[model samples]
Target: TLNKKLIEKSEELKQLSNDLSSANENLIIKDRQKDDFLDSVAHELRTPITAIRSAGEILADDDDIPLDIKREFLNNIITESDRLSEIINDILYLDKLQHGEIALNIHENNIIETYKKALSPILHLIQQKNIHISEVDLLNQYIFEYDEARMIQLFHNILGNALKFTDEQGTIQTKLSEKNDFLIIKVFNTGKNIPEEDLEMIFDKFYQSKNQNIIKPIGSGLGLAISKRLVEAHSGNIKAENSGLGVTFTITLPKKIINNNEVEQ
Candidate 1:
């Protein structure tokens, strides 16, 4: 009886040892992932900082430079500084949202109006690209309870990406439809499609598509990641697909109607 009890105890100890080993392995993997994320953030910050510093130095040291050239350098410094601030703000906002520190102010709003608000901020870029937005399905009639600002950010990021990738004089199409209790929004741009492998990880943080043609110079590769988090926070889903003509991003949000005076979230 004593010998049998000792064997059982030894077996239990071996199982515990295996579990601890597995846990340690998992910790190692997560630690490496954290390190990689930090490294990317550092690089993103450093790029703009370096640009700003260089531009400032040129403006300060070149006393004999032409007035027009000096003005251009000053503009470059200001633009780079603004870019740096944007990156920092985005990173901080994402960190807060991930930690559940941000609260949603959900309300019933029209999707089309919100989309227009988002588009207004980037109209200059759109004009520069000579892109035409065609056939916007009337979404103003569809009312949904959600955080208006966050929804605008979501559409802004998606539309911005579409604008970045679509060729000059290309077309970007938006469509919205409701099926059962879900509202679906799709944005399609006519240009090079994303690589098949990237479609799977496109929403991942700091994940940049291997398709080089669409990568813009100023992107920190965090916009889609932030957009995905914001959508999920509102009990919705977002996805991307590579169509024959280009890429399409789709968002689905749940809809519920209660009494005439109220809407369920």
Candidate 2:
């Protein structure tokens, strides 16, 4: 009997050792992730700050600079400052979303109205590029219950990407439909198609495609990652695919939440 009790204790100790090992491994992974996130934040912040500082230095040190050049330097300072502000806001918003500190204002909202609101922010860029837009909606009266502001953010990020990558005078096509108890939104832009391997990583934080050739705003590379989180928070799905000439972003949301009490419901 003593020998049997000793064997049982030995097994329990071995199991405990294995569990401890797994816990240590998890802790290491989390630590590495934290480091990566902080590094990205630092890099994003430093870029704009450095630009702003350089621009400000030029304006302050060069009294003989031409008026046009001075104006350009001032514009650069303003633009870089705004970029810095946006990155900080995005970081704060993402933290709140991840920590469940922000409450969603879910209500019945018109899909078209939401899309328009999201596009408003980027309309100037669209016009400057002369990008053509087309839309198709099969749902007669498209309405869904969602957080209006968050949904606008979700669309804004995706639409911004579409406008960013599409060539001058290129076309952006959007489609909305309802099927199988889900509301689907698809955005396709004509320009460069994303590499096959990068499709899966497109929504990852700090992930950016190396092939894009567009000149646009400097970004923190958190837009798509945040959009993915927002979609998941609403019990929805977001994905991208190569559409013959370019790439298409597709979002799917449930038509109705069963209980509508859970965060993802």
The 0-to-1 C-alpha lDDT of every candidate, in the order given, reads 0.82, 0.84
Q: Could you tell me every candidate's TM-score relative to the true structure?
A: 0.87, 0.88
Best by TM-score: 2
For model 2, what is the alpha-carbon lDDT of residue 123? 88
User: On residues 1-265, what C-alpha lDDT tens digit does candidate 1 reach at each position?
Assistant: 9999999999999999999999999999999979988988998889889988888888788789999998888898888888888888888888877777777777788878888899899988888988988756673488888888888999899998898789899988888999988899999999988888888788877776566665654776689888988888777789899878888999998774222221212
Clash count for candidate 2 is 0
Q: Write the per-residue lDDT of candidate 2 for residues 73-187, one digit (tens) a residue.
A: 8898888888888888888877776776666778898988989899887989998999998888734678888888888999899998888788899999989988888999999
Would you give me the overall lDDT of model 2?
Answer: 0.84
Write down the worst ten-residue block by lDDT for model 1: 256-265
Pairs of colliding residues, candidate 2:
none
* Cα lDDT for residue 113, candidate 2: 90
Off by over 4 Å in 1: 1-22, 256-265
lDDT at 80, model 1: 80
